[model samples]
Target chain A: MPKVEFNVDRCKGCELCAVFCPQKIIKLSEGINKLGYHPATVKEMEKCTGCAICARVCPDCVIKVYK
Target chain B: MKVVFERPRALSDVTTHYCPGCTHGIIHRLVAEVIDELGILERTIGVAPVGCAVLAYNYLECDWQQAAHGRAPAVATGIKRALPDRVVFTYQGDGDLASIGTAEIVHAANRGERITVIYVNNAIYGMTGGQMAPTTLEGQVTATSPRGRDIKQAGHPMRMAEMLATLPGVSYLARVAVNKPANIMKAKKAIKQAFMVQIDDLGFGMVEILSTCPTNWGLQPAKAMEWVDEKMIPYYPLGEFKVPGEVK
Candidate 1:
């Protein structure tokens, strides 16, 4: 399965990854992170195409994609 | 599993100080990615300017020097001359490069300094709480230009890429945006070419990246990217303004 990983601590809850994800699989978690902001995560691992668009538009460089 | 995308080796493993949606981090990542791809991480020297990106040394894991407001090109010139073999580049914002550091950049490029300039033109002074900048578009509201930029009062916005393209020393000059994935890819290519100009001992090279200031723009992160496409791009049109060999 294609996968996407988030360095939760580095995320700023910008939602840019979610906004750019072609599959719309990235979402912000309800839980606050180390910096007190919601971090983005993959909503459906199976939906990932490993396009890496999320990683490309992430302002904080929070996501890494694998296939 | 094959990794499609990962952190660039040239980037530092640390959180950036940028706001939730600022595009500066993205630009930093692109530069780091280019450095790693070109295998110039070991010899690259960056001069960070006094602006929102002043702490660029924190994100880009390389030998860096902090230049005073708008003096990045001057500092970069000194570094390049002192260590001619090293790849020297300067990362500066519109407030630093277009407003305060205008003379430094003009002279540096005019003299054909073998240095790469990564100019981030977000239009407004992002770190200074959205103040008006030299490149701020006409009729654009900002902390300083609350009523919108009046062309009569402030004159027209500066087209840094086109203005600098006329310089005889400029080896390469291009303007690109990072609002989307496709544009970001082109941005990376321009950045790589800018760095290559320095490595090849060509004259001054600059890649004017049209970035976003989401916090100051008072828009959502996503909307900010859209604004770049809807507003900034039309005024700034992305393309190569000058190429080294095609001087004619």
Candidate 2:
């Protein structure tokens, strides 16, 4: 299984990861981070393909993936 | 477990000040990744321009010098000439490079200044409230051009990559967009090649990246990227306009 980690504080909540995720497992959390934006989180880790598309699309470089 | 992706060591650890979904962060990461891969982090000197990426020095872990508005190429010239062994580059935006600092970039490229330039073109001036830029496409709506840019009055969109390719001094010139993962990968490769040209002492090199300004464009991050693909790519086709041996 692929593991995804997000540096919540670094996320600006642009949601590019969510938009680009091939698995569509990434989504914005209801709660805001220190910057007051709803940072992205993995909703269904089991479905994540670890393609790292989220990391590639994320402008903030806040996502990391391990396989 | 194998690491698929992580922050490059060439990037600083602090959070960036860019707006949410801003493509500047993506461009910054690509540059940092290239620096790390090339093993030139210690000797690389970046000249930050007077635009949204003015604080690029804060995000990039390398020696940096802040340049006057549109004068990054000039400052980079001086730095490269003085410290010939150092790898120098300039990070500039459309307003800074195409409008205010046009002469500086042209002269530097014409002189074969042996430096790399990362030009970010977002169509509008992001730092100055979305004013129409020289690279702004025809019929594009900006803060200053409420009714869209009029080609008769504003003239045509400036294609810097194609324009710069005409100069014999330039060794490499390419235009790439970060709208999608495949494009981002190609953009990174172009950036790396630009740096490599400078490293080999070929000549002036540049990679013009089509970026997005969602806040200024009044669109969501995803939509802004779509706009880039829909509107921008038609006018500015992405490809290597010039290469060392291919040109001339």
Candidate 3:
């Protein structure tokens, strides 16, 4: 199972993960979080391979991956 | 694939305490890999600074010292002078290097000290609640500069690499990032070059890594990398800032 979590407040809205996501399942949300940045969302969790690549490339650590 | 991503021998088995997406873990691995590859793990002495990486001594397997806030350069200077044959490097952060230790770094480079400095410039201070740092960009908001860094009030971001490259004593200076694997490779090369310069008895060498402090910069892990690419790169452009004795 691929599981991802984001600490919404920590996100700074850089969006590097969206560019690197192999499955392209992640996207920034339309609504702003407490940090005033659109945090990433895993719209299609089935496509995730649990590679944690998105988590790895993120600089903010807002993303957490669990398999 | 038996084990391509195993930890380096120079790194201890203790799991890193860095926050998720914190590139400090990756940077530590890179340093340990270089130390292992150079066959200097036994002779290398690393100096840890007072920022997020203050506990680096705990993770790195080689001999280590914990220096006061922004004093890693001075400590490394002493260690190198006392043991010229050993490899000495200081791992420091933006706050440690660009702020309180500015004079130390400047004098160390100016004196041409035979040491290597791994300067991690994440723009904001990671520890102590994400305060605005000297490297924080203009209009880049932080805990201190909530309205964004005001050039009129806070002055402009400091370009440590460009500033030190111009000093006569600095023999090698480069700025690399860890936003991606390709960039990580570049950072590794630069790090190796720094240590190789030290081994050759070359003068001062420093590699300023434009790292992402996702926790401090108020960005998600992925976005922090994006921020690095979109914002940080333009201000602190990467490349060899200074390299003396080149054939070219």
- From the highest DockQ down, the ranking of the candidates is 2, 1, 3
Which stretches of candidate 3 lie above 4 Å from their native place?
A: A1-67, B246-248
Each candidate's B-chain TM-score, in sequence, is 0.98, 0.99, 0.97
| i-RMSD of all predictions | 0.7, 0.7, 7.1
Residue B193 of model 2 has an lDDT of 97
- Poorest stretch of ten by lDDT in candidate 3 chain B: B1-10
Flag the better candidate by DockQ, 1 or 3.
1
Clashes of each: 0, 0, 13
True-contact fraction per candidate equals 0.81, 0.85, 0.12
Model 2: residue B90 alpha-carbon error in angstroms: 0.1
Q: For residues B190-216, could you state the per-residue lDDT of candidate 1 as single tens digits?
A: 999998888888788999999999999
Give the best candidate by lDDT: 2
Q: Is candidate 2 or candidate 3 better by DockQ?
A: 2
On residues B1-248, what C-alpha lDDT tens digit does candidate 3 reach at each position?
A: 12223446886766455665678877887888899999999899999999899999988888999999988889999999999999999999999999999999999999989999999999998989899999999899899999999999989999999999888888899999998868988998999999988999879999999888878887776678779999999999999988867511
lDDT of 2 by residue, B26-98 (tens): 9999999999999999999999999999999999999999999999999999999999999999999999999
Model 3 per-residue lDDT tens digits across residues A1-67 = 6667776776655666777888888888898987566778888887877776666555444566767
Better of 1 and 3 by TM-score: 1
Quality class of the docking in candidate 3, CAPRI style: incorrect
